[model samples]
Target chain A: MTETELLDALKAALGADVLAAGGVGHDLWAQVAKGRVREALQLFKGTLGFNVLVDHTAADLLKWPGGHWAGVWDPCQATQGGEHERRTQTDGRFELTWRLMRLDEKSGLVEGRAALKCRVSDGEAGPPSVRDLWPCADWLEREVWDMFGVKPNNRPDLKRLLLYEEFKGHPLRKDYPIAKRQPLVAPLPAPEGRIAPEQLRPRVTDPGLVE
Target chain B: MTDERDPQTPGPGSGALTQGSGPPGVLTSRLDAAIGWARKYSIFQYPFVTACCGMEYMSVASGHYDMDRFGAGFPRFSPRQADVLMVVGTTSQKIAPILKRIYEQMMEPKWVVAFGVCTCTGGFYDDYATVQGIDTIIPVDLYIPGCPPRPENVLQGLMLLQEKIQRQGLHPKPGTLRPPIR
Candidate 1:
């Protein structure tokens, strides 16, 4: 289906859930209410033949000058570059973006791509996990949680994908200090267990520890 | 009968042997100088390479530049066997501990050479992820400064390290600190 047809179908199916919808280049783009993310993605994947989840990531819109939603605005659009007035909101938030693509089954070529985004309020629950629909969402969601602290509801394993276990705060967050250091006190023991036997006889008794 | 050539005065053709004139055949030199000569030419290096700087390092080690001529051509994969640690790229905070562990595992009398601007001073990445300088984590013996230093600069740095090794005592006295390399 064409971009407009799919968008019209979505608008008809999810009338109030979609806040805004339009075309950006050849791909269709939409902004939807955060709670309806799963339903909207399900419709795209199951009914519209958009079987592939191209990419998934979140943008911290806390300090964005254009607005919370402006973070995801396509810069390539002709109407985007004019002098715009800022609409400052008291509450900080994050915008979660997911790019989906449809492919022809026989040729294995991409037929269409659509960009969908939703606003996730900071300190609140994030959009539902789409791991069941697209297994690739597993690590992507984990990375979002790790970097932005946006907890995806019902995610089975939400461990930090990039940072170590002891890392305290999400470093990508706007509020996180850039120079704050969290040096490890001592090296963690090797995960593979002991590799060599202890020496029974040694020439030097004192092997000093590295400072 | 008086000999034409005096015993103390060397013959005209013996200039090569009589240049130092200390002894006829014995060549005397400081113990440190001899040890330094042997050590300078056989440095076994461990390259802790982890970024774009590795490209430059590869060039230095390859045939055109030939890092082997400086005695640092052989890269020891294990820390225990290496005498020099050449950290060749950006070291992130995440990798700092691993770098430290590798440095500690190397045997004593080992030296460290920070091989790029990133490893020496963190380059343009002055952020939380990058460890500003590797010297914060471990002592460095020499630093080669460049975004990705040319092979010629690396060779010059190697020569500087050789000079440093040549001046050190064979066996350091207890509690005596080796002079720091500028």
Candidate 2:
């Protein structure tokens, strides 16, 4: 759908939940409630003609101070050289960002973005799994889990993504260390001589422990 | 009745032969040395590739100076099989310990080749979550300089490793770099 049509449709469907709607260079964005995300996006895809699930990711903008939101704004519509550009609230929460490309054939170049502020459980836990709607969200969700330590419920593989298997802390957290590592044990030596035994030897240290 | 003039030419009887002065000795000894050298150089790496600089590390293994041709094969999935630990992307403080454990799990004589700017010096992410330099925890052998170096740059790092082996030799010494305690 056209930018105006999509914005109007979201405003009509979600009402007060659709916080802001606008276009930024070659892209459009709409801020909505977490509860209305699936339905609102469905409206955009089924009715508005945005078919492709271009991308899905999340950002943690926690540096902003309290009681200082200039109304929720979409980065896609953020202007480059505006005299009245204001900073939006960057509170420590998962701002779920999605990019949708219009596929009406005639209006295929148009793309839209929608940001939903998800209620992070325990103040830092990630959003609920979007895997049921978007299967590709699995990798992206895992990444968010690995980096931010944000656990999205029902994720099949919530283990570390970029970090090692035994990594301790989440590196992408706002408070990761400058330089440090937990203690590690050296590996045992390989068997000597040519004929390596068929049976494996037990490791010297506890295999359960991180090396 | 057999022609003895061209000994270099393989004959039915001379199944195993060599042009060197010495006899064809034990094949097992040669096989052992070959295996030893292969294990020494071709360290199957498990690159925890993340961020921008991982691209440069991939180039190091690509065509031109292919790492596979020179012994360092492509990365492996299991840490048990891999001999070298290459932490290619930016590591956070939380993940630092995990990277360390992976390094520790690699068998003895294992080497770590620190690739790119983020890993070697921690580059722009020298902040709270990101670890400044991975070398602070693990002993780094070769540090390739670049924010995201070219693939040839990785090959250059490999060549530098070969030079280091030529200088220090492959076997670990008493005090070269202390192995992890127990």
Candidate 3:
């Protein structure tokens, strides 16, 4: 299926959940309701055959303007509803994105490419863990958590992935200083099975020098 | 005491310059000079290669540049058997502690050569993740400052180290300023 057909199928299946949808070049993206991300992914995988989880990542939306629709035309201004739902997310601070791919089994080719995005408020928990859906999400989610401190519920191992254990804050956060360095610890003195200082060879081995 | 010098041996009490008897010339020299000469000519190097600078180190050891001509061709993989530590690359913050441990494990009287700009001052990697300079972890003898330093520069650095070894007194501190030998 083509990207447009995939978006149409999404609009048909998840009518109320897809807030805004459009194509960016050949690929397409759908702004999904924060709570409906897992449900949408399940639909894409279970029915539409978008089995390949291309990559899952997130970005800090700290730079985004409040209540301003970042689309081709303001979907909120065109909305007939009293108050557009997209205009009410003044508190939304992070944009979690998931790129998925549909692959043809017989010809071994890509059938479709689609992206799903959801805005998460600053204090809210991250989107549900997709480790069960795609095993690669295990580390990818952990990395997101490590860098952004966005906790994903039901995640078995949600600890720092790239930074050391003692690292204080998520370094990728906008508030985190770029040049800030963490305290480093030296290794323990004299590990087990290490050769004793005296047992090691003498420093000088020159024959001409008399001790 | 074994016939007070064998007939084949001829010299003035073992300290004289002999001619035409035992291989022509027999000249005596100070014990210090002999030791210095020997130590300078045979440098056992532990090349702690970690980054791109290792390519230049390879060329320096290769036949064209000929590090063997200066007695630094055989790079001892183990730190225990080495007299000189030739650190030849960028050192990241993650590897700094390990580098420190290696430096500590090496025997005393060892000299450390910071063999590239990265090892010397972290090169362009002046950030939180990369070590600013290896000297922050261990003492350095010679700093061969280049991105990966040319073969000629490395040879010159080797010559400087050799001179340093020659000038040093007994119980030689390889890189420090020791008092003049009496």
Candidate 4:
């Protein structure tokens, strides 16, 4: 399906959930409803056959003017064989993207991407866990929770991944100070020559002078 | 009682430089050259990838500027057989000990190449969780600096290791300071 046709289908199916639909760079990104992500993604998968989940990663949406942005790539356009033996014409293929992709070789591929805006708040519930759909999403969502304080609800493991268990705040958020330094680990008796006293030794004067 | 030496075996004072003779420096140098050649041609490495720079490391190993041509192929899983440790990613405080253990498990005469800004000097994460530099725990032989260094820079570090091995014969430089040899 063409980009416009796919967008129309999404709007019709999702109603008020579809925010903005326009070409962004080489692909199409739709500002979507925060709660309707799974439904919108299922529509793209079931109707258009965008069955490949290229990658799922979250970006600090605060970079944008509106909200947090999560990106997912669709490999529905992937084809088999040489040009002469092409299975189908995918010259200017449209990648239908949401937040997830369900893989099934027999049905062919449909581009799917889903993005939901998240509010940065200690009080805000994390984005719903999509581990049931894509297991790797478990880690991705936990990272978001740990880095941005955006909790992914129903997540089995919500502990921090990049920071120590005692780390108090999410370091990636805009409000988090860039200069805050955590207390240093207790020194390890400094490697021999690195300490002041040991560093004073003179260099060996002969080639045969073993340490 | 001292045993008499055979006439054919020559006396201890003889400046004997024949095959299977004393002072194996020549033999050792030859062996070092061969190992040096192997080290240059095929530096099979186990990547301790952990952060953003790892992506760039993968790019170097993949297409564009394939490192495989020079024999520095990336092996994800660490096996004792691999001698070169390419710490291409960040090391956390929790993971630092693990990295040290992995380094120790590697056979002797192993070389470590700290790739990218993080592994080289902790990049900008001078915090508690992330290790400031891998060298703090493991002895690093080469440091490649870049926030997320390009593939060419990684290859440059590999070449630098090769040059060091060829010139120094992979033996620690003589009289270059050491912990008093017991």
> Which one wins on lDDT?
1
lDDT of 2 at A92: 38
> What ordering of candidates by lDDT runs from best to worst?
1, 3, 2, 4
Q: What is the TM-score of chain A in candidate 1?
A: 0.76
Kindly report which residue pairs in candidate 2 clash with one another.
Answer: A1-A48, A61-A90, A167-B98, A169-B94, A171-B92, A176-B128, A176-B129, A185-A211, B59-B151
lDDT of each residue in A174-199, candidate 4, tens digit only: 55665454533432334445544235
Model 1's DockQ?
A: 0.12
- Predict model 3's lDDT versus the native: 0.72
Question: Could you tell me the fnat of model 3?
Answer: 0.16
Considering TM-score, where higher is better, how would the candidates rank from best to worst? 1, 3, 2, 4
Residues forming the 10-long window of minimal summed lDDT in candidate 4 chain A: A85-94
Scored against the native two-chain complex, candidate 3 gets a DockQ of: 0.09
* Model 4 global lDDT (CA atoms, 0 to 1): 0.58
Each model's DockQ?
A: 0.12, 0.08, 0.09, 0.07
What DockQ number belongs to candidate 4? Answer: 0.07
| Model 4 per-residue lDDT tens digits across residues B23-138 | 53432224555556666666768888888888998898887888887777757476487767888888777777678888888876577888888886577666546776776677
lDDT of 1 by residue, A1-211 (tens): 7766887888888887777666644587777777888989999999998989989988886656656545455443445453222222324388788999998889998888998888888788888899999999988888889989997877645899877777899988877775566765342332233232142242223332222
- DockQ head-to-head 1 vs 2, winner: 1
CA shift of B49, model 3, Å: 3.5
**What does the lDDT read for residue A123 in candidate 1?**
82
